[model samples]
Every structure is written in structure tokens, then in C-alpha cells.
Target: MSGSQMGGAGWEKLRADIQKSQFVLVGEDHGIAQIPLFTAAVAREFKPAIFVAEVDPYVAQAVAQLVAQPGPATAYLRRYPEALCFFDWSEEFELVRTLRAQQVQLLGLDQVFITTSAPFYAQLAGLVKGKVAKSYFQRQANKYQAQNQAFEKAGNDDFAMAKQPQSAIDSLGLLTQQEGPAAQKMAHDYALSYTIYQKQAHQLRVNLMKQNLVQALLPYQTATGPAAPKMLFKFGSNHLARGLSQSVKGEFYDIGNVVQNLADIQGQKSLHLYIIGKQGERAESDNPNFPAKRVGTYTVAENPELLPFLSQVAGPAWSAFDLRPLRRALTTSKLQLANPSLERTILG
Candidate 1:
């Protein structure tokens, strides 16, 4: 009902909603530091018949193989080239380890549409093929001018106050609007080339959905009487919507979109959706209003059980590995789960 209650009370309601509905889709804000913990909590609470993540299917398959055959977390981390910069495998690996320990079914939801090289080539080809489309060029030019005007306006407003000049914002605006036409032409050409890629992506997406659904539903399909009441799908927020918000009708087709499309294709009409976003300076007010409850915003705390394992690996270096040492200290000293009251309430 309120922002504070969104994490705990809202999550409890979400679990309940998932239990009674045919499907539940949880969307997440990107790089939300709290998401790993939130996801781990949801998996534990609902013990959802199935769990999925934003990981690509190929990567997922690798993860599945690794999950099935337990090994060092480092081995698993090596598989993802994209994760090297910020994500240490330990954070997510711990969740995978926990889920496997709990015997939860995990699925990866990303489907690759085109090989990375081909799309780059196609985009380059499109840019060289013609005089940049006139309309596209004009739109880009107008966007550049408008952005410049906006920066000047913001600067003027800030200057009215007796504050130090906000050169950073002004500088960033300059950087963003520089090379207006060439940038626009490149972007438009890339988009034009991407149209071909999108068709392939869509087809791959459909196939991946069909495959995942078949596997997820296999248990129920083989069972007699009324099947299990519900399922929880964990995927990137990107996959939850239809597509980028800019495209016409493209706004409607993500994993949630895929689910709806599947339901329509199969003539079913009853599934529920639940999405989660991280709390930030922008505030929840900036988020889109979907027809679901707002769960509370939470920050991730290290799972206590994980520390001993980490300690074993890092040895004398354990302190370095434990980023939130206070949380870890509280967890270890208290000999308690973090936020037990909230956890119990949600699990209940």
C-alpha cells in the first residue's frame, strides 16, 4: 500500500497472488543491487514450481549443466564474458547454489536473435548504402537542437540561484548533442539494419518460449487431476515488456508479452503479473504504473550462510571479499537471518 511496505507486505501479497494465479512475471530494474537478495527471498518463499532469470539460453544451458553437476563457483563465472566488469560470480552464484540446495527448478530466459558480428556489418552496410534518409536526418537534427535548448534552459535556471556553475550537466549536454547528423545517421542506419535482426530475434524468442514452457509444464502435463495452481517466472525487466517503449505496439511484447501471446495462441485468459523495481533517487514515482501492487524497496545484505563458504575460499583475505562487513558482522554475531520478521512474513 505504501513505499515502506512494498518490500515486505507487498512481497507477501505477491507470493499469495502467484500461488493462486496461473502465472506471475516479476520485472526488475537493471543493476538494482537489491535484486539478487529479493529474488533469492522470493524463490525461497514461494518455492515456485519453476525459476527463470535474464541469462541467455546458451548461458543458461551452461548454468544448468553446472547446476546439475556441482563444481567451484569460479568455473561457472568463467562462462559469462559480459559479467566481468561489475558482477562477481559469488553474488549470483550463491543464489544458484541456494536454489540448487533447495531443489528449485531454474530456467534461463534470454534467446539470442542474431550473431553479434552480422548485425554490426548490416548496420555499417546500411549507413553506406544511401544518402541518410531525409526524415531520419531531420528528426535527429531536431532532437539535437531541442536537447541543446533544454540544457541552456536548465543552466539559466540554475544560474538564477547563487550556486557554483553546474558545468558537468552543461558539458554532458554538449557531449550528447555533438555531431548531430552523423550520430543520427549512424543511429538510424543501425536501427534500419536491426529491423532484419528483430525478425530473427522474434522467431528465436518464440522458439525459446515454446521450449521453456514445454519443459516447465512437463511435470504438470504428466500429472493427473487438477495441475499445480501456479508458476513464477523470473526474467530481466527487458524481457517482461513487449519491446523498447519507443516503437508502436512494441511497448507490449516482453516475457509478460510472450506469456500473453502464448495464452492468446492457446486460447487461455487467466494469468497474473507482478513486477519489482529497485528504489533509487528517481523514486518509485518515476516508474510505470502496471496493475500490480508495489512491494517495498530493499537493499541486499549478505546471506550469513554464504560467509563461511567465502571465508574458506578467501582465507586470510576474507575481509576483502565481504563488501558489507557490517551486515556480515551483524549476520554472524547475531546468528540470525537478516530481516527475519520480513522473511517470515513473506514466506508465510
Candidate 2:
């Protein structure tokens, strides 16, 4: 995993933390190629029993099964186009393959991606026994085909699931009300995701994520069983902050906060790490309809607070800064910053 961009010092620090912590969360910028390699390395060192990611639960199940098969990644994608999320990126696919190859369990606890609607509708149509319900699902799938086309041309979320008419949502709810447990759960989560997106309800979304996390851990928490399973989480930076997450207008407790608190309750430790490129290219878009194209560049130097870390980054290779020293200094009142904003960003 030398290509991971992490230097020797970074790996040493990471190994030490992984040894001490029951939970490790890696908060990252989404599109970098090196982050996946770095993540794969961390998975090797941590050997987590569960790896939580930022995709839907159903998508996670499909990915786990897909990588275990003996075939090219593209073949699985071609067979179930638009059925998977982040794995469409080759780097991301390799990361999942590495984790699954190590026999690690994966749990996805984020809202369904934008590409999820049509294939999901098609699957539901195939599963439902009622002719009326099947027809409704089929029609919805066809409608999404048109919506996707228009979305591509417009490059807007006007066709997002959150914008679906209320009557259509009510109809969908009615059809799945009496289905089996799996179908009902999918339908319920699907609708709730839509509501969360429409309202921009960060707290509600994090609540659902926490609920999923708890549900995933329940089996490992039995009184007669061994200690709670070791876990590693990968998500966008904002979702994994140790305290109240930073946002445009407000702050809220996120999954990182929950994981840290969970570790505390279990009489163990959790390590939170944030990673980003000092200056490099990032994917132009997250649109799953097409192959990811890297079209833009970003520099962390734009933010003065990030400059301290970016200045230490050498060349194109990955560098890691141990924030523990800075955190400790702040706690002891040995470090003081004239910029209140910088202090908040670092302390958080």
C-alpha cells in the first residue's frame, strides 16, 4: 500500500492508534484516488470486524456479494448498472474488494444515492405479487428513466427523489404497507431518506445513521458474547467530526460523536482522523450515470486554518499530522490562537 501516499511516520502513528482504539473513523474528501489506497492499508492494520461506509444498506449487501465472486468488477457493474454507488470508481472498487477479501463485514448507513430509484423500482416490481403494485412500480421505473435523461441535460436536482409529489409517495407507501419485512423496511427507509433530503434534516439523517449503527452492533453486544466488535468507519469529513459537526448555518452531533461516545461507554477508545490533499485534482461530479471524470483541482491552502497542516505536506506523497499534540496543548492552555475561528476548527 505504498501508493496510499502515507509516509512511514503516518503509518506508525496510525498503527499505534488502531492498537489502542476499539473504533477508528477516517473522515475524508470523497474523490481522491489515494484515500482509497490509504483506507485499504488501514483496513489491513485494523482488521476490523465491521466496516461502516456511506452507502445504503441494500447497496452494501449487493457490494459484499459482488466482490466475493470470481469475475472482473466491470462485469458485475454491467449486470446491475446503476445498482451500486461509490464502487463505480475503480479505486473505490479496489478498496471494497480488499476489505471483503479480508473477510470484514460492511454496513452502509447513509441515504440512498440518486441513482438508486430506477433499479430499486424495477426490483420492487419483480418482488411484489399484486398486479396493480407491479404495474405501479414498473411505471415508476419508466418515469425515472425520463427523469434521469432530463437531469443529465439540466444538471440539476429538480428531478431528485425528494421532489416527488406527495400523492405519489402516499401511493408508494400504500403498496408496500403489507409486504414482507425486507420490502417494508426498504420502502420505509426509501421514503424517510426522501424526507430527510427534502428538508435538509441533518439531525434526522444522523439519527437514522446512529440507529443503523446500533442495529449492526446488537448481535456483538450480547452479555454472553465476546467484547463489542472492532469497527472502522469511512465517511465524508463533515459526517465524522468528533464533536458538533461544522456546517454552513448550524452545527449538530454527527456519527463521529456517536462513535466516540459509544467507545467511551464500552470502556474503550475511538480515534478520529481527517485527511485531505494539500493540492490536487478531485472528481468533477458524483453523478453515477457516467464514469467519474476528474475535471477540477482544489487546494487546501485556501483555508488558512488548513494551511498549518498543508504546509507540512511534502511533494505528491501523503503526509500525516498527529493532531494529538495540538489537542493536548490546547487542553493545557499552552497554545493560544489569535483567530477564534482557527481555534474552534482545531479544537473541534
Cα-based lDDT at residue 224, candidate 2: 50
Q: TM-score for every candidate vs. truth?
A: 0.42, 0.88
Name the regions of candidate 1 deviating beyond 4 angstroms: 1-8, 67-72, 76-80, 83-89, 112-207, 210-230, 241-252, 258-348
Model 1 worst lDDT window (10 residues): 282-291
After best superposition, candidate 2 residue 26: deviation in angstroms? 0.8
Let me know the TM-score candidate 1 reaches against the reference structure: 0.42
In model 2, what is the error at residue 233, expressed in angstroms? 0.7
**Per-residue lDDT tens digits of candidate 1, residues 1-348?**
221123544456565644555555555554444455556766665565566666544445445556556554354232222221112333455566667777766666444322222222233334432344433334443443343334333432111111213452232234324345644544433342244344445544544565656555556553332243345565545455422221232322445665655445444432333233212321221111211211234332323333333344422111212123444544467434555432221211
Q: Looking at candidate 2, what is the lDDT of residue 310?
A: 78
Residue pairs with clashing backbones, model 1: 6-295, 6-296, 7-295, 7-296, 239-255, 241-254, 242-252, 242-253, 242-254
RMSD of candidate 2 to true structure, Å: 3.0
Query: All candidates: CA RMSD in angstroms?
Result: 18.3, 3.0
lDDT of 1 at 321: 23
